[model samples]
Target: MAIMVRSWERLLLASIHDVSPRFESEVDSLRDLLSPHVGYRIAMLVVPNHWGNAPIVAGSPFASRLRDWADAGSEIFLHGFYHRDQARHQTRSARLKSRFMTGGEGEFLGLSLEEASVRIAEGRKVIEDITGRAVAGFIAPAWLYGPGALEALEEAQFALAEDHFRVWSPATRRKLASGPVITWASRTRARLASSLLAAGALRHAPLQTLRVGVHPPDVRHPLLIRSIEATFNHAARNRRAARYADLLD
Candidate 1:
């Protein structure tokens, strides 16, 4: 018998989500956890105004810190215009998803194309102004985009946009087929169970690309934090660190 070695490019896409003035400490803590162990660039999914409040003002200490991270080679992504759910759902299923699935936090769940465009543009500009850097990508909060999200994303001229399962080029609408992401939500028992199952499954799967999306509140739970650390260790075993922007290039 002979042994055969297979080689593939493995990428670890890690990000800290819901970044705003209110969640600064949590984001900072997540960054500290990722800085040494991941050995790759991480994406910071910043919300211009989170929950209709806690806006990121320009030239403030918070904005300055974001600039520092951008200078250090981390990619900054516009998460959402306002990370709050206000859209009215037309269908029962949609309403159920909005209220239960996301805990009423899917900001773009039912927006029209024109409205989505305006909000996305506003968020992009605000982030650019605050960070003094070009915002290259956008990711909807909770990985949920409404009817006009793609169109709005295209109009905003972001290089890339990501949903829960995959990343795509906004310009061409082409899917990258990267792989499913491993994410956690500690809001409920069902969410926790599903997230744990996904993490455990991906830990042993020999995949070419692995993404880990971390929410600011995730640090509050010790079990989630441990799972995050373990997932990073397992994924980093044979993967290189990468940013969503890198996927564009």
Candidate 2:
């Protein structure tokens, strides 16, 4: 008998979501928390205007921070125009999903194709203007999208896009990474418990790509903090932490 071994390394793709001027302190804390465990080269999913409340102006301090991250080689993504869901869903299933999957945070979940297109374009421009570079991609808030959102993304020509299950190229619409994104939830006690448990289990699961999506609200929970550190630590030990764009190559 002959012995053989596989030599490829599994990748760890980590991102901080809902990034906006409003969540600056929380984002700072999360970034600081993740750096030692996962290193600082993590993706940042930016919301140009959050719920139409906070907008990133070109010469603001937050804008400088975005530029610094881009300069330091972090991939910037247009998370959503306004990370709020107010669209009217025609179908019962769509309405239920919009409510249950996310608490009115699925901004693209009910947008028409034209509306989705306009929001994506405006968000991309806002991010690009701040970073002085092209956005790496767009990922809808709550990882939920309607038919029209998909169509708009298909036409956006972004290099990549992601949902809960997979990361794909919007340009070619090719499935790049097929895996569940591991994330924490501090929104509800039940969800928090389940998410922590899932993080523990998924950290050791045999998968090619491990995607970790951290929200600003997560930094507030101590249990979630520990679990997040544990997940990233385990990932750091076992896999190569890389950017979302790394899936392209």
Candidate 3:
């Protein structure tokens, strides 16, 4: 019998939202954990506009460190214009309902094509300016995007778009790879459960690409951090680590 070995290129993508207190430490730990690997690359997703305020890019303490990471060859991606709900609903509950409906497309689905294009373009500019580097991709807030969002991405000239399950080409409009994704839930128990499930899957299947999604809050969990390190080591042994931009090449 052939020995089953999980083979997948590991790519870590982290989403950083409203300047949280834990942001600095989490970033430090992540950098320390992944820096030693020869080919490891991370995509740091930045939420430019949250709560419809001025772009929060400049005010973040970790912004400088993010730039350093990019300088070291990590890819930076624009997460979303705002990481919050911006819909026509009147009530708070209604607004929440609208935000995530249809995976967040509903919130911006009503936007005119021109309006959507404008928003995406503006966000792209802000992120690039802050990082002083070209952003390689766009991932919508909550990994939620409408069909129209793809068109907006193309107009803005983003090279990649990462959704909930797969990484897609904005130019070709097709999935490049699909396999296990490591994402955290709100609770510690849920986060642990998901990491265990992901690790188990990685051990069994022919996973071509391992996409690990992390949020700032998840760094607090010891198990989550351990799982991340273990996953990286596993990938280093079996597959090359790459950034989303590598798919283009």
Each model's Cα RMSD? 4.8, 4.3, 6.2
* Superposed model 3: Cα runs more than 4 Å off: 1-22, 38-40, 51-63, 88-115, 188-195
Tens-digit lDDT track for model 3 on 55-153?
455656555666666687767777666655455544565456454343343334344557667777887787677678788788776665555676787
Badly placed stretches (over 4 Å) of model 2 are 1-7
Give the per-residue lDDT of model 1 (tens digit) for 15-75.
8899899999999889888878664388899999888779888889998988888877778
Q: What C-alpha root-mean-square deviation, in Å, does candidate 3 show against the real structure?
A: 6.2
Residue pairs clashing in model 1 are none
TM-score per candidate, in order?
A: 0.92, 0.95, 0.74
Question: Total backbone clashes of model 3?
Answer: 0
The CA lDDT at 213 in model 3 is 69
| Local accuracy by lDDT, each model | 0.81, 0.89, 0.61
Which of candidates 1 and 2 is the stronger one according to TM-score? 2
Q: Is candidate 2 or candidate 3 better by lDDT?
A: 2
Top candidate, metric lDDT: 2
TM-score of 1: 0.92
